[model samples]
Target: MKWIPQEVETYLSAKEYVDTAVIPVYSLSFGEEMKQSAAAFEFISLLTGYLEKQFTGRILLFPPYTYLKSEHIENVVSGLSKWEETVVQNEFKHIFYITSELDLRMFENKVDGSLIWLPSLPLGNMNEPQKIEVVESQAKQLLSIFTQKWSNHE
Candidate 1:
């Protein structure tokens, strides 16, 4: 797909309206091995480039996060090694992302104050209350330091 900012701007300009930009969160693992897979960060440089050109002072492109994964620790580690700094330094008004159950602990050391984390809801037999509880626990841990807004979605 084309850079998200360009796509969003085209739609907005044609409609002549202003709206909050909500970039869909992607699994951060794709960043480390983009040579091996297609993911959001590969185009992040493109996004940043477009932001500089189109909305220099007005737009923010939220970075994606490592989402629900049961066995991709290696992938996550590689992604963090490769893209964490760039993502952290992105010139945007906000940094929004998703967080899965597996990496919650590791996130403590990696999180930056500007990032918004969307909690992952487990699939299958997990009930609504149970899911809420799961995210609540994670939220408490996050709230210990950061005060950014967080929303949970399945």
Candidate 2:
């Protein structure tokens, strides 16, 4: 389920079964690093969308948790901590934070949720079909990770 109103309504109706929340973390930047930032955004957005579709009834795909690339890592972690508290309070059993920013991995243990750091795959040159194929491939790889987390909780 996505963050859109219609999907959210569906989620509200069957909240019990939606035990996982996936939040994509994006590091935005302007000037010299703009292209890199955009690539990461596009790649992660597509990847998470694919994941949501595959696990539709079981996961809620939240909007990307975006921050400037120049921001301090401690601040970013602090912000994510707040999000973690809210999601946990709302009864989500699993929280997965997906990001292309490698620095986030260093602070993964500081946050309660699982942090999945995927190196950004440049998708700017790929055609639509190729983009889908790549995203699907990456999402397929993620299936086992998510299922493993679910099994552990169960």
Candidate 3:
């Protein structure tokens, strides 16, 4: 569920079952390739929304954590690791960090939660169907991973 008032209220009452937290980490692109950055952000939102819909009752969708693309990987990973602390303290047993930025993989092992790296999809001129197709496919892959995690925990 998104971090809105209605969701938060529901989350508070049902926090027992909401054991997972999904966070999208977006890296800001500077310079001439700004269009790609925008596209990436849009795509992440679409993918995130899809994930939330499927796991609304079990997962909490925190706002995207944005960082500069050029930031030091060490610092980025360290900061993000801390993000998991709050979630864990709040009773979330599983935390999934999703991102479309390929560069972040370097620090994946250093982060506190599982990091899902998605290939960047440019939605510049895609038709509605194409966009839906892309999002659906990616969401399926994500769900598969999440399902595995759940089963393993069980």
Model 3 residue 72 lDDT score: 83
TM for every model, in the order presented, reads: 0.33, 0.98, 0.95
What lDDT would each prediction earn against the true structure?
Answer: 0.40, 0.95, 0.88
Superposed on all Cα atoms, the candidates' RMSDs to the truth, in angstroms, are 11.6, 0.7, 1.0
**Cα RMSD for candidate 3?**
1.0
Q: Which is the winner by TM-score between candidate 1 and candidate 3?
A: 3
Best by TM-score: 2
Q: Over the stretch 1-154, how does candidate 3's per-residue lDDT look in tens digits?
A: 8899999999999989999999988888779868888888999989999999999899999998899888887778878888888778888888898888887888788876889998879987999899989999999999999989988886
Cα-lDDT of candidate 1: 0.40
lDDT of 2 by residue, 25-63 (tens): 999999999999999999999999999989999999999
Count the clashes in each prediction: 0, 0, 0
List candidate 3 segments past 4 Å from native: none
